[model samples]
Target: MKRDIFLSELEILKGIAETLNEGTELKAVLGECLRKLLQLTSLEAGWIFLINQEGEYELVAAESLPPALTNPKHQALTQGDCWCVSRFRNGTLTKASNIMECKRLENARLGNWGDTYGLVYHATVPLKAGEEQFGLLNVAVANKEKFEAHELSILESIAYQIGTALKRIHLTMKEQDIKIVEERNRLARDLHDSVNQLLYSINVTSSAGIRLAKEQPIKEIMADIQRMSQHAQAEMKGLIWQLRPAGLEEGLACSVKKYGEMLGLEVDLSVEGISRLTTLQEETLWRIAQEAFHNALKHSGEHKVSVVLDYKQNTVVMTISDDGVGFDYAEGTFLPSMGLKGMEERVKCMDGKIIMNSKLGEGTTLKVELPIQQRGKC
Candidate 1:
């Protein structure tokens, strides 16, 4: 029996390592870790506390926790220091063998709710990678009891793995932020050189027109204004095209397909008669498709989604459809929910139209039509 238990615990740890290696988002990874730990170990309830930038251990994930433990008094433990937490903070609680019953639970049991969860003894492991400690991992079962030596070791190992994954996640987020800021700065510089300069020229021309009202021809000033206005429009479109979308550079179809895969959905993509599309048109279509895909996954509860990107003369048509429980979209009643309003606003900005087709218990389809080439672009 002991051998079998050891093997099962090892397998659970392996599964958790694989999940972290996949570069899954941090929150999802932490929740999955807690769940796997609960399933494999004697612990019935578990939670993870992560130290935020403010250096306070916040409850980021929990499983099977009772209402009393989640109440305002217990939540204050996030920012407040307790014996177990302080031991970890002071570098005394380094290993899982340093087991102790939680004073917080003892205090809560004395409260009006009356030991709502029966939570007493808990194993507190520091989430440490190298010299850095991210936070603490707490796991407990009902009543006061000591944990086995092997169990403590397993819990400690899992905490170390979580710490390592947290480090990677932190670095990944930092890199992404730096990239976004750099891209925005570059776009700002481009706008200043192109559109900003042109607008300034228009301002100068108007001032000259006012000064030379009798000497200058009104038609010439009007012509200058028209020329500058057209150029400004084109420049603005170019800038908008450069706005960020995770997988846009690859292609709109590819980006949407990858997005669905990330959401654990199979997306069938069909593209026809398109060698390439103008950046502005591609971006607008991509944003609308992204919003539609998110809505389908969140509210639709569908396993599979279908996407089609078709290019026709002077027009690009994209459709996203899902087979899930649909709602009655009256445009007024359901506009705010399911994020349809935001999608509509995006389409309007692109000077395009979005058609919604759905019925309760049927499905949803978002059909978008955008001009392939806007003013001054072929």
Candidate 2:
């Protein structure tokens, strides 16, 4: 009857385990599990071991093994001396009634340490669920006493608790990795289509202009090439930086002013209330500005670039335009316009829209507007 009860309890544990599965974090569930398991089994002490990459068991959570033995200092096992370590790795739960006398534990990893080990009676089981195994859960007694069959069932159930919890942690980690990869891909495409193109134009044009200036008496040509060369280098640097995680303080106005000065572009940035926005909004604004400012300095035959940031009563708006000879806003320009599409996508992600106003003879104006989102402060 008790054996059937123990099996039913394990079944219940599997169902109620969804709580631990919801998160990869282990501290709360792990502590709760050990506390309940020790009480359930009436064991003198219970200790949980987590397998390291080196295939050694490290003490994670423990009760009654003393502070020193509960958190063992000599954890790493060498060679085939780890008999208990091998037992769990084979995907089976095992027990050694008397660790000092068990034949299977002869020459096992950490076996020699038993004489030095303060705890004597040991019950070891693999912490596993399905096919994946994490490590071993072991209980030890200072005195030489064997566990009854009922206590063994309790120990077995504890293993299942750890197994289910660990499985949840693994799933959470995998999902997190997926999200990171997706974010990286989106950002990479944005960089390639926008920043890469502008830098390419600068590099190509500057090289040609330099060659022409050398052959002919064209002082202005040489100056133009020199300027474009510097700006291209700056664009390359800026693009690489955007591919990385941006620091929270590095906003649109600050980055543009610093980068423009670094590349010798006389930039006037008028940013109002940029710092007050959420981190996501700030990042989106900063990236879009990077592309637009690149356009004004490199392609727009403009002397100065102006970037204005403003937040209205219920709207956030940013306007970046150049006093350059603006070209006709046609689908032809848009087709080859990687920068425009990237800017649009970024604004869309922020629940915003973009407007472009340009004339062949006059200058250009690019405006972005987003409704004030009810976002909680990070």
Candidate 3:
């Protein structure tokens, strides 16, 4: 008889593990677990609760429960608390404990609202894993048989599995939150580099036009204003592209060309090899390219720019160059600006390198080299 009981308990534990692993949905997993518990222990009914963010217990799942126990007016599952739940809620009952008789059941029997069905005893187990407290698991039975130590141990093991599942779900939610924050930060950086700079340029151009109006030809001043207006339109389009993901879907090379065309610059793009990269790596390259292009447009005064993407067996290299006059790199006086620093930080975070080469009267070249297997490590 003892051997038969041990086999049954082992089978129940196997079923519980399978139930938790089979699904990622919390309520479905927990509901199935409660059902299996009732089958294994000969319990009449069972319920599981989850503590909300506000520290109140909420009914998450139940099985074979009586109507009186589930009624909203009675608030048996929602508001009212029995001795077992009260003890569990107050941190007094951290493990599976038997309640010889529940006040809730006794009160219902006395009031004659419904049949207690001989369910005078129940057990409560704190559903917890590590430091995470999910809520409580309750099971009731009609028989007067006292819960054995082994029975409580089985309950505790099942509760531990449930808690493990909940912990994974929690961590998954936190990861999603982190991704959202990262996206927001990317949008902020793009706006600052593109739209904000264009606005500043418009202000300076308008002021220059005011001064030139007194000395230069009206036709020339009008032409300058027209050019500035075109730049404004291009900036607006770039901002819209950043807001929407259409450019990203079209591929990085095509998107970069479109951005350059909008800005009225000649773009020469070259791809030497083909390879695959993670979405994050692709986005990083695209953003760094956009920043380099913006710098060329604003400072290089070059009519043409070149961008090259080279994919090798173990590494990918990017080169951005322009034909405009460049500054001297020998002067240690050229401190890194915010945009440059941001680019450098991004490259370093990915275990990459950024190299800049320039001399007076020569154009600047920016090179970025990144390992190909960075995503594989993740």
Which has the greatest lDDT?
3
Q: RMSDs, each prediction?
A: 20.5, 20.6, 18.3
Q: Point out the higher-scoring one by lDDT: 2 or 3.
A: 3
Q: Write the per-residue lDDT of candidate 2 for residues 218-295, one digit (tens) a residue.
A: 756766766876777566666555664333346556765775665567777786664456555665666676677677
Q: How many steric clashes between backbone atoms does each model show?
A: 0, 4, 0
Deviation of model 1 at 133, angstroms: 0.4
Off by over 4 Å in 2: 1-22, 26-32, 39-41, 52-56, 67-82, 89-118, 141-144, 204-378
Full-model lDDT for every candidate: 0.69, 0.60, 0.72
Candidate 1 lDDT tens digits, 74-178 = 563454567766766677767774346566666566665444577777778888888777778888766646676887788888988998898788667546645
What C-alpha lDDT, on a 0 to 100 scale, does residue 120 get in candidate 1? 71
Displacement of the residue 70 alpha carbon in candidate 1, Å:
2.2
TM-score-best of 2 and 3: 3
TM-scores for every predicted model: 0.54, 0.45, 0.50
The TM-score leader among the candidates is 1
